[model samples]
Target: MSRISVLVVDDSATMRSLIAATLRRDTDIEVVGFANDPLEARDAIKRLNPDVVTLDVEMPNMDGLTFLEKIMRLRPTPVVMVSTLTQAGAEVTLAALEIGAVDCVGKPGAGVTAAEAFGDLAMKVKAAARARVRPLGSAPVVEKREGYSGGDKIVAIGSSTGGVEALLTVISAFPENCPPTVITQHMPATFTKSFAQRLDRASAAHVTEAVEGAPLETGRVYLAPGGHTHLEITSGAHPRCRLVPADPVNGHRPSVDVMFNSAAKHGPRVVAALLTGMGRDGAQGLLALKEKGARTIGQDEASCVVYGMPRAAFELGAVEKQLPLGRIGPAILDLCSAAAPGRDQ
Candidate 1:
């Protein structure tokens, strides 16, 4: 296969160099050019037509977000955002993802080594190179859905890579009093809090980062925190969130498999959906849920940015229905509605 060519764009010379050098360590990636600002980056893009671009969240002349919006509107090229690990940076990075960036990596912080920060940069670059990027216009106004009764069922969702945008769409369509929902979106440790805040603003359901012993209640959505804890559910009359400090499962803390498997033990009154991501972390766990008679849904390939996790689940016979991104949210709600006829339990 041809090497994945990349253009490094950052305002700081040190960041550009560090990013280029780190990507060079991977034989599969080639740093085609560097740019100190969006102007130079635009020139480089026209000149090199690199397979992918690594963009900084902040830049001079024009801000990265404005430039990114322009690129998605015109060129529609896959981009991976490089950002700092902070609340401010997280908000900007999430905006970039919604603007069509494929993934993100954080710059080294105080006491954090460059090696640790850039460890996953090359992998993300490769994923971006293969990502299906399309022009993203203004987000469609999702008219809030109604008539959703908080039945006995609960909802579980897992996503990564393109999940920020996907989750925004899904959650926005939810009614004010939706089912008790649990989500595991693979992200850096510091980013989940900001993302939860973003979700809460967009969603009628109360969204929060999972804390220990939070009961699964109607009108609430618990997002698994991103750090060293895995979010699990304790099965019983009152299911509650449990944060486990165990080692990473499937190379991810707060693994989707851990969450899905835990939900499976809660019996058949579960509704689960796996969205776009770049690994098989949730496939087996979705299969376990299917075996226990839980309703399962997967985002179809045409609607996925990477189509990795959802594809794995579909192939494993875990997905009872595969639908486009616009439809999965309503489908999950329909399955969990009190008016829906009885299924195996």
Candidate 2:
């Protein structure tokens, strides 16, 4: 395989050098060029045509968000945003992701060691290089669905990699009164909390980060917390969310497998969907759901950024249906409504 060529774009010379050197630490990644600003980056992009771009969220002449929007609108290449470890920077970085940035890394602070920060940046860059990003004009569009109901139905959704944009589409398609939904998206604690907030702002349905002992209610989507805690379901007269401390399963503490397996065992009628992500984290758990007679769905390859988890599930005979990102929401709603008759929320 050819090396992943990268272009580092930042106004600060130190940042540019630091990012370039960090990427160079991997023999598989090559620092093709460095750009001090968007103008310089534009020229480098035209000249070098690198595989990935490491973009600083704050830049001179034009901001990173604006440049990112332009890239999504025109070029459609994967972009990894470099942002400060601040509240405002977090907000801006999330905005960039919505505008088509593949992923983000917090810039090392005065107190943070560069080695540690760049270690993460290198991984994100490699992931970005493998991601399939759609241009802004041609991206999937999911409209808000109506007539969705909660009929003793529970939904479990899992994703990573391309999940931010994918979940935005899937959750926005839900009605104001939808089934009780649980989600596991691989992310950091800071990013997961911010993501829940962002999704709450964008979606008609209530979306919040899952808290231990929270009741599973209609019209709300609970996101598993990003930490050493795993989210599970406790079946009874009233299903509720449970947060448990456990070793990372499949290398994720809040692993998709943990959530799926829990829901399948406890949920009365489970509607499970695995979205785009890398690796085999959710495959066996999704299969477990299928064995328990739960309705299973997977995002199809053409719409996936990585297609690893979904593909693994599909090949394992776990997916009852494989749909595009835009269609998965409606299909999930359909399954929930059909699972139990004579109930609507």
Candidate 3:
């Protein structure tokens, strides 16, 4: 079989060498070239035509975001961002994903082992190589106008890997009257608090870490605390977050399936979305939601960081509409407002 070719782009020679070395360890991946900046990367792209590109967020000539925007506009290919593990870095990484990068990996500084910095980089690169590329013009941008006027409703979403950015994009698009949104994005316990806080700042909805017994309210968003499986509503009259200590489901602690299943039981006929992520975490639960008559949408393969979960759901006939990442939020609003019996909005 042909190996997956890669291009490493970073202003720092050390980082570029480190990333290239780590990726080359994987027999299936071949580091075809390296570039010091976006301008240099452009020439490499025309010459080598690599299957994927590992880009640094901060660069000299042009920042990764600007390069990503240009790449999406001129020639959309799979790109994975390498960023530091700071709050500022997290915010920029999220923006990069929204702009067009397939996924992101945190960079480890000196004294950190390659094993540490490249924790999941190889896997992400492999996934990106297989991903479908779409032009930036075809990608969805957040809308400034109100798209829905609906009564109290709930929106349950779940994702992993590239979800940090995907969730932000979807939630930020929501208006003040947007339905109560609950999310279970796969992340470490140490990061969930910061992630929620960051999302709260960027999004209109009141975002907070899910606490046991907290009432589910419209216009507020809840994130399932990491390190535990957060199940959906237990009762119809009052739906609250349920966190449980259990073995990881579908290889994720805060599994999407667990949340979706809970949502299907508690918020029957509500709107649900399964965004980009690895593995089949959300597929079965989404199928259950579909069976319960909830409007379900899956991120199209072309827009996913890793298409595993969404593809599984799509193959199982669970998704009602397969949409690009940009259209997901609007589609949810439309579904909530449409006249349907048993649906709150």
Candidate 4:
């Protein structure tokens, strides 16, 4: 296979050099060029046409988000954002994913060693190179459906790259009486709490980080805590969340597959959604869910940030419906309602 060429974009000379050096260490990745700002990056993109770009969230003159918007609108390519691991940075990085970034890696702190950060940077770059790209004009939107029965129905959602925004969009459309929802979104330990809090503030549903023995209740949303795998519905009468310390699955500690697999075993008749992400993590688990009689949905390629996970599941016959991001929420409601006995036909 040809080497995966990359363009590094950052304002800091030290950061640029560090990123380039780290990428160079990987035989499969080649640093084709470096740009200190979006203007320079644009010129480099036109000239070098690297397979991927590692972009900084902040830069002089033009912000990375603005530049990223243009990149998606004009020449869509795989982009991996390098952002600080702060609340503000997390918010912006989430936005970048919604705008079409394949993935993101937080830059190490000031006191941290370069070797550690470089290792992570190299991995993200390689992942970005393999990510599937989509046109910005044709991205998926989350659609809202009315007239959902508020009973014992359950909803399980999994996502990675662009999950924060995509999840917010889908869940926000849910009414206060929407079904009990459990979510596993790829995020760091420090960020999951804040993310759940943010979601709760934005939506009508009560959102909280999942805890062991916590009952899955209606009108509530549970998010897998960071740094731990969250298994679903261990007990039937009062479905509770289980947290376990395990090795990362598909390179994520709180993997979507782990959650979805558990859901398949415990809540086979529930509704499952596989959203935008960068790898084939949830594919097998979604297949398990489908085999066990769960209604499964995958975010369509056009609306995905990377289209890796969903595409993998869809190809494996794991997904029952491939819908745009906008139509997913309503579709879930429709599926659940159809399964109900006395609901409006």
TM-score: which candidate is best? 1
* Candidate 2 lDDT by residue in tens digits, 110-212: 7777786676677778888888998886769674456665577899999987888889889888888888999999876667888999888877789999999
lDDT of each: 0.90, 0.86, 0.81, 0.81
What does candidate 3 score on TM? 0.81
How far off is residue 49 in model 3, in Å?
A: 1.8
Rank all candidate structures by their TM-score, best first, as comma-separated numbers.
1, 2, 4, 3
Q: Would you list the clashing residue pairs of candidate 2?
A: none
Sort every candidate by lDDT, greatest first. Answer: 1, 2, 4, 3
RMSD to the hidden true structure, all candidates = 1.8, 2.6, 3.7, 3.1
- Model 1 alpha-carbon miss at residue 22, Å: 1.2
Among these predictions, the greatest lDDT belongs to 1
Q: Once model 1 is optimally superposed onto the true structure by TM-score, how far is the C-alpha of residue 34 displaced, in angstroms? A: 0.3
In order of listing, the candidates' clash counts read 0, 0, 0, 6
Which model is ahead, 2 or 3, in terms of lDDT?
Answer: 2
Better of 1 and 4 by TM-score: 1
Model 2 scores a TM of 0.92
Worst 10 residues of 2 by lDDT: 336-345
Residue 234 CA displacement from its true place in model 4, Å: 2.7
